[model samples]
Target: MPNSTTPSSSQALEAVLARVDAGLDASLERLYALLRIRSISTDPAYAPECQRAADWLVGELSGLGFAAQARPTPGHPVVVAHGPDQAGPHVLFYAHYDVQPVDPLELWHSDPFEPQLRTDANGRQIIVARGASDDKGQMLTFIEACRAFKAATGGLPLKISLMLEGEEESGGVNLPPFMQANRDELAQADIALVCDTDMWDRQTPSITTMLRGLVADEIEITAAARDLHSGMFGNAARNPNQVLAEIIASLRAPDGSVTLPGFYDDVAELSPELKAQWQGLGFDEKQFLADAGLSLPAGEQGRSVLEMLWSRPTCEINGMIGGYTGEGFKTVIPAKASAKISFRLVSGMDPDKIRAAFRKHVEALVPSDCSVRFIPHGGSPAITVPADGDYLRKALSGLSAEWGKPAVITGSGGSIPVAGDFKRILGLDTLLIGFAHVDDQIHSPNEKYDLDSFHRGIRSWVHVLASLAE
Candidate 1:
């Protein structure tokens, strides 16, 4: 008879990793099956498809011994699954089954729903489909890791819960409500794991430790009762376009810092350790600007490009409209001028306060005769994971071991509102780890996930879970 005793951590990890490697083909097959589902959640036409995706997930999780069910919401359903009660740290894994619409379908080399494994010009195997790298492929990495654990050890080392929602692409209007209603059940987990982000590069893995928040608004300035011929009004009338332009220009100082009053009041300085780590990333600022067809950095004088992107706040004019935007020239000043503006906020800053400050700044800049109207476009605060957390260090070590390179800690210039929602609602800090690359082209046609990324992503999760359990 074979000796039957508890396997050491290294033995268990090795077994699970071998299982992951052996099951790579099956894992790809399962991911391909998921990508075949046209689960576009934004459009009303794909409602049934969204439901089908949710149902498929429930079936898969239930088959894996989870108490999985497709729970109803005001919009699409959320698949909530729970594993058998265990003794280790419980983790809630979050990912969306829904994908962005595959519009401009002619641009795709193949059908977006029919995923294919093909080699790129650089000779790397990639899986091509709409949601290949966005979430479908990424989400399956965790599930496949669990499968390997089960196959190798007959059970998982820790407790697990899965939250796969179908409305993330459509603004996720109902997700907060759904979470609130089930807060007691969902909050039981020790931490949340999200897999809807990207890696720093092809060779280096990354954990997004901070995500900047957003505050967006639209402003309309009306200076005249009706459109007037410029010749007739000539240099005498108050021009809303000129007024709007001046206000936009005044938003930034010559040093490229936002000039709003008290804009930096709540902003925190980056720690010395984090600054050192980011400096070691060897980011080519010149090359970065060259790729964007620019010659110089445009934000925050004396700050590195990464620091400006990931730490500092920003004010940008997204769009502007006043008069005579057509092909031909019209010598008239329109009665109203409008502009869309947005602010990217860092940690410690409140979105509501930022929005209010922006409105106040614009109001002060408006001409006495001109009237200004504001339209709110919603806001969310920034999210930051603690640098010294035990879970974070363990996860990083796991990734480093799997990838054969030291994993990096990076910050995102964009926001994932769900991370904030997780903290606010469930009182859980989320670890935003994903294996997608920058060129994955998610939300665009011809989206793909590197075949190696998918395979090693499973093993990476296995390592992470084992390290956490230890």
Candidate 2:
């Protein structure tokens, strides 16, 4: 076990943190250089920019004493940089250089690519740009940490294998294949470090230990052979819309918990310690509900807001469509209704099992006159990091020392496909220490990153490397 009495280490990092603060202007300059690259992976036009972004990372990593290169992949290139792959516990640090597009350009107070250092309403300074927070701002936290370590100890203490992908925001299709082919090169590490998540509120630093997995399902409920006029067959004809509603209603109980059969069979309950930690959040129900313009809890009854959003499993309807009413009301009973639903599963809850349960629920809800067809979109199970792992504890201590605040262990409601890819392709666990804030608005307009988070995040990594090296 690593000692928590690293006052000297803390003092050393404090000095580096001050340096990071004084040199924050230069860091912003670097970020501006990256943000200027329009590396949107989803669109074909930004392909060259994507490669350019990878090249930029190669330069930065190489400057830090790593033999880094921009490796060509099937689509965009991956920047693989290494310092030492030898003895001490290895870590695969993951991030993405590619960003989302800036459409509806008229909405911006300033150009999206040209980063501006602005302050939010609460007087917190933020870096405003398209990719400022989504990743560029976030990933630099780790890179800056490495820089601080280099400045302090002359090198990064642990064996570091950095893998920054260009296609993470898009579906990560190329990443799994690459990991499959280079398992030895990538998965040699005991654990992976991912910086794609967010901080809990603004004051609380969190480590994402659990992420609910998902299974995308598209279901079409077919009733009559043709669209029926409500006046012609108001009482006799079966309505697919009604059938679809019945199917959705049957998915969960009145208490707001998912009712799919066997959905809870494999789910593991949150432990006492985790429960206490979540409770300590001192969550305000009104503020949380108000943030969404809501007044009621939508998940399982009697569970804390943290539990419902992070720990509990759920089945939600992403979309629904059937009939047409373009202008005024059209009094026609739709012939078919379709709904897309997904389940947020916990560890051990197989997507296959949840899929089967969902289908069975729909089948039971289907009327004798109608047939239902299902379209499988995608499926995956939940991820739970080993709470007792050695490196896990080190990371926790690292955050505590850097921020002078106890690190909060929490679960994510959203999912990252690469974490699952690491397990499926290379049998490795991921340590997610993300620095993005909830209000960063990553994929949307007006994206920003807190200046404090950007600067402190780097120092956090410095302490983390020291802990891991020990």
Candidate 3:
């Protein structure tokens, strides 16, 4: 068993914390250099930029005395770095180097690649760039923490393995195969740390213990062979648009329950204890909705917004197109209509089963004259780490000390596929801790990470590493 008591001297820990504070300017400069890479993995034109980012990380980690290399996958490369060999528990830290593409570039205040530090309306200093808050800024936090530890103690507190992927914002297509191929090297760690999630709020730290899985599908319905004028085909023709709309509309009942048969068979209910803990967090549903220009919560009825988002499964249509949707009106009944849909899965739900059930439901809804086609995008299972493990307790204590408030054990509605892969392929459990805020606007224009989050996040990792080293 791993040591449960905190290790390292108080003076040594304080020295590391002070070093982190003193190195903030250098850390920010390094982050700025990385942010300028334009490592957008989804676009083929930026492939070289992704490689550059991976190479940069390798150099940086090597400079810190890590045995680092940029290993190539079928897609973008992954950077693997090992810290000083130590005797205690080993930890594998994971973060991504790739960022979402910056579209609608007109909305950005500055070039997404040329990172800028600006003060928001609240006088909070923010680093603005495409990947500032999503993963770059968060990744740097752990690296900076390791740097501070090396500077203060002459080595890392514990054995550390760093895995930085370059294909997270885009689907992580190659990570699974890479993990399977290198399972022995990666799975030797006692625990894993993932730094790609959000804090509960600006002032409150959080550890995400649950992540919803995902299943994405694209559906196309075909009727007439070609587009037809609505006036000419009036009541005689079947409109694929109308049929697709009806199918989408039928997905949810009046109380917001999904209409797919056997959809709820595998969904597990939240334990009363867990529900009580969430209730104690003072989550303001109204404020959460109002921030997004909404009033009432829109999920399953009789459930709180937090429960609906974190625990329950959901089906949503991400995009739909059937008829003429240009600036001007064209009264035409299109030959085909299509919709992109995704399902947020909870634990115990099978992605394959959900896909089959959904296809059956859509087939039943399709008219005899129209045919439906289903194209699967991707699927991943939900991941839940034990909330009461020694490593988790250590993280909570360390984070609580750093933030001066207890860290909330929270659940993420979003999916982090690698976390599940770590469990399945590596036999490791991950602790999801990050410093990004809800208002960070990740994957959106004007994405930003608070200067405070960057600085304190480093210090927080220092604490966590020291505590885990015990």
Higher-TM-score candidate of 1 and 3: 1
**Residue 39 CA displacement from its true place in model 2, Å:** 0.8
Candidate 1: regions farther than 4 A off: 1-7
lDDT string, candidate 2, 240-313, tens digits: 98888877887778888787767788877888988987888887988889998998887888888878878888
Q: How much does candidate 1 score in TM-score?
A: 0.97
Local accuracy by lDDT, each model: 0.91, 0.83, 0.92
Which candidate leads in TM-score? 1
- Score every model by TM-score: 0.97, 0.94, 0.94
TM-score leaderboard ranking: 1, 2, 3
Model 3, 178-278: lDDT tens per residue? 99999989989999999998889888999999999999999999999999999999789999989999999999999999989999998878888889999
Residue 19, model 3, lDDT: 96
RMSD of each: 2.2, 2.7, 2.4
What does the lDDT come to for candidate 3?
0.92
For model 3, the superposed segments whose C-alpha errors exceed 4 Å read 1-7, 228-233, 327-331
